[model samples]
Target: MGNQPSVPQPGTPLQVIGAGLSRTGTASFSEALRILLHGPVYHGGTQLTLAASSEIRPLMDIVSRFPPQNASEKKLIGNLLKQRLDGYAAVTDAPFNGLIEELVEAYPNAMVICTTRDAESWVKSMKSIQNAVTMGFLRFILFPIPGMRHFPDFVDLMRKQWWYLYEAGEPLVAETYYKHIDYLKRVVPEDRLAFVDVKGGWGPLCKALGKEVPRDVEFPRINDSQAIDRLAKRMVQEGLKRWSIGFATVGVVLMSYVFWK
Candidate 1:
């Protein structure tokens, strides 16, 4: 926990909770949910880019500190959700996957959507997107400087939540993925939960949400490997630029001091 606050800021209650793992069309589902619900939908991208700075520590603390088995942690979990996730109508990916139990407790009436793809496909996608992104960040940003290993805020959160926690390799990845799905199945009520594949498109999702399928719009398919790789490269370039600027500033300061002396 970076900074522990006693209470979180109030926010609107959530209406939908996505219990899906990454590479399971979470981005597409987030887009669709935003459109259908006519409100903000939190995704991994949202976690990285949009969430308030104060919220991040509590999120990390809650996930790492409070295992569901501990009865005392429930209140802390509720407080964390209310503080961090109150206004979002829906939440998916990264941090949210690890908080399903707490989310369901906080929003008992909200629908749960568990997106699935074949495990083989999911693993393949993860290798391309997740691994590539992490490696790019490491190679171009952190590895160059021994003391500068901490990532930028969003990437740091992701590193803690995803990569650091589950870096054992493919077997662990598969285990965590299936374990998440199984946990949702066990915890959420049948009526409140919907298991779907992105390929099922609007039919299953719409039916689950009790809304009519949109007449003409095709379902969204986003965050392919190419796009993710491009983002990774952009991040690397940006980090390198920042590092260069810092070095230049330091050199200028040192030269100015020597001249004055």
Candidate 2:
């Protein structure tokens, strides 16, 4: 049964995997699951940091949270955590088989979803976030030196993330944010895989998941990087102003002390 179609038995919990960008229609899908079926859906929230022992527990716990529901779900979740934390599998260069296996097994009796936005849009959003983070970091390190060059071209910084992706050997990581969609198409039965755009909203998705859309629940959109970037910039500007004022105040106090002495 290593190689079998993902056919979920009726009335079992659903599992959704992948980074948020996978566009699996998680909130809508999860909301639908919670309403229609009492299954607890688990989505991965943080980057996998192999160094922290504390980090591994969260990953393991999330996987373990799924009640064995069946022998298959039990084994699938087990293998998923094993492969996920293994050093080699954490790198993009490693074949994606382990994670793929978990997805296939866990999602068999349940609807599994994966998604990707347009490449250009993904790159733009990624760059905006990266720029804000890197700029903040650079300011901290360089503020003391006084002559260090500041960063230029947030786009270039964004490009570096793509390069890092390539170096990690999953160069197509961004391009194939929807790769799981293809995987689900090829491996899981056509009826099971729901390859869809989140932008299309809840109606089509509810129908695909075999549930009726709730009229009361509007699709809760999240993490729009464009909006996030705008907010990050505003916060950064405010932080800089605060830092500048603090520096000036300290400098004035030092001068007064020196003059008085």
Candidate 3:
């Protein structure tokens, strides 16, 4: 199929497209972008996890059709994501990392930055996040909530995007990273593509985006493992709280039924 809508939809404001996976210092990079862009950014996985019920449902359907099979499929995915991302300055992190090519082509002018870290270190961090996700099972915990019933589909979407790494193991995870890097190098033009290893601090990123390095602001170093764990715990608490409300409502209904009976 032809490139996925190379021209941005009319009046679209997105200026950056991130083709980086989680644990590639993506959290820190995202925070940095927030500082630089002075606008909202569509952070990939986290947004999907916490999106409104109305949004989560459509997002689930869209993501489940990954690796778009045809040009039309590509447009469908691109148009929907663009609609969601229209107002944002940029997007970074998981699932979207899998859509790097499409996004690169979709918004030809957007700066494409691939967040990078030492491969071994990145894979180790990735495994920790994977454990947090799998053992914690955020989807299962939240499934009972009417609003979050489609959570499993979101998980499935991530799984499909990272099938090579998730289904296999670390060796493949490292391999996948390199392969992605190679893809970026091959497909993305030199002028627009930037590789930011956040550990190196803000200089590299600042220079890439044509923004002077901020002497006052300390570069963010968000440990995603800790962040993800906290998120899972919060979601679990929310789920249980919702279940309690549902039970209380049912109890009230049952009491009324008995009284009327």
Candidate with best TM-score: 3
- Which pairs clash inside model 1? none
**On residues 89-177, what C-alpha lDDT tens digit does candidate 2 reach at each position?**
11111112214445566445545444445765655555554555456364663333222222222223334433433332222445444
- Tens digits of per-residue lDDT, candidate 3, 113-187, equal 998888777778777666655655667678776656676667666677676433544334577778778778877
Clashes of each: 0, 3, 0
Error of 2 at 169 (Å): 5.9
Predicted candidate 1 versus true structure: per-residue lDDT over 142-224, tens digit per residue? 43333233334444455555543344343235666776677788778888988888788889989889988887888887754
Best by lDDT: 3
Better of 2 and 3 by lDDT: 3
Model 3, backbone clash pairs (residues 3+ apart or across chains), number: 0
Model 3 bad stretches (over 4 Å): 1-12, 136-138, 164-172, 255-260
